[model samples]
Target chain A: AQTVTQSQPEMSVQEAETVTLSCTYDTSESDYYLFWYKQPPSRQMILVIRQEAYKQQNATENRFSVNFQKAAKSFSLKISDSQLGDAAMYFCAYMEGGTSYGKLTFGQGTILTVHP
Target chain B: EPEVTQTPSHQVTQMGQEVILRCVPISNHLYFYWYRQILGQKVEFLVSFYNNEISEKSEIFDDQFSVERPDGSNFTLKIRSTKLEDSAMYFCASRAFFGANVLTFGAGSRLTVL
Candidate 1:
């Protein structure tokens, strides 16, 4: 019933530069959660950051942050001071709130390449 | 930090054969989930288990698929008959409880069906 879309299939950035990955979703639920996950070459899905729909303030975790626009149903991730290790497949995921199970709907991941 | 562990990093099997993937969720976690991703595709939810029973499942989890917590620490996903299309990386995830939203995921088991 819910769908997440990552318009960009691939992205590249130079080391120490900043990059933003765009994500949008179609959902009818009012309360939900959003997350950004990074899968490096090792194929381990690591949580980058998270944001709650109820909170307008964006979430920031060290070098990873999110621009969450609840009304627009858009949540984008920003990586600052990108390192080569940041190169990975980035995924935007969504989950409904209010007594619902943590079933995640993920977007078509964007492959990020950070140059040294 | 506590992490979810999955076995058989990679497995190759023939069509119509049975395959079982195993995972060990975090000890303190109460919720467990199985998700899969075909090569170059987004991750898709397969099933969620809680209290030793499946709480929810997706359309992708058909009769051929089954999940079990045979012991206190291990959760397993069994495919009765593997198909070529079933080839994918299967991930096991767990969360602390109902109010905890973040689901920690394992490295995933890559299954190749020939």
Candidate 2:
């Protein structure tokens, strides 16, 4: 079974500071995709960033980015210039790139709190 | 700027009763999915559908759970007999054929089985 692990249960950052949320996964498949999703109190899950396993370059989307260490099987999300709106339950998810389409294995999630 | 939409933002049902959660995925999307998040737990994948057939399902999806695309526009999940453990925030998601990794999720339907 594939499993994603987010070690921190909760994290907090002052407004304008940067924070990194750690994630690691165990999978036999060589090719896959890693994702970071943010769920606000509204319960809507929004995509933050995504990284393809084969890519040596990490993925970055505006304020969000990922440090993907394929060797370590670690994919961590970094939120830069954090704003109050970034406060939410952040989840790290993994999806197979080849067959077994679209099923995402997710971590237990890290609740992010942004202080004003 | 299309997004997946789900109905009945919240539903409360008695144990052993039936419940149906409805979703309307973004038009033109070829893949659909259902996921659930129990409070204080990880979000779990329930099922995935494509081309009128199930593509994948998690262990959490079993005989008691069924999915259907009754019409071209609507996808629904039916729980044969609800259990208290079934209570969770159920999310419907859809993805474009090309970018399968990017799934657009609905606001979600919170199901509470008492």
Candidate 3:
């Protein structure tokens, strides 16, 4: 079984600044996918970004990016030029490659607060 | 972009009662899934359906729980006898046929068992 861990319980970042949320996972499989999802106060889960284990280059979506270290089993999310809307509960997820299609194991989650 | 939609945004029921949560996945999506998040807990996968049958299910999906795609667009999760522990937010998600597809989730239906 694969387990994702988000060590940071709560994080705060000033508007227009950058912040990073840490994530680590345990998986023996060589091929897998990692994702970061954001759940706002409304409780709607939204995809932030995703990274493929085979890719060496980190994935970036607008202001959201990830620092993926496969060897260390670490995948951290970085939000640049953060805005007030970035405040939410962020979750790190892991999915193993193979017959499994959409089964994602998620972390406990990190609450992000954007300060103006 | 098309998104998944769930009906009965909130449902209140008594223990031992039967409840069905309905969802309409994205039109073009081929894979559908159901997940639940207990208050203050991480979302947990319940079951995954593809090609009109269950492809995978978690231990949490016991005999009391079942999933069905009664029609082309509608996907449903039925609980035969609800319990207090069943109270949680149930989410319906869908993904396209392409490999390594990302899931699109609905707003979720909050189920409260009294």
The model with the greater lDDT, 1 or 2, is: 1
lDDT (Cα, tens digit) per residue for candidate 1, span A1-116: 89999999999999999999999999999989999999988888999999989998999999998999888999999999999989999999999996555999999999999999
lDDT of 3: 0.94
List DockQ for all candidates: 0.87, 0.87, 0.84
Mind giving the per-residue lDDT tens digits that candidate 3 earns over A6-73? 99999999999999999999999998999999999999989999998999999999999999999999
Candidate 2: residue B54 Cα off by (Å):
1.3
Q: Candidate 3: which docking quality band? A: high
Q: Which parts of model 3 have CA positions greater than 4 angstroms off?
A: none
Interface RMSD of each: 0.9, 0.8, 0.7
Residue pair clashes in candidate 3: none
Q: What's the lDDT for all of these models?
A: 0.95, 0.93, 0.94
lDDT of 3 by residue, B43-73 (tens): 9999999999999999999999999999899
Evaluate model 1: give its lDDT.
Answer: 0.95
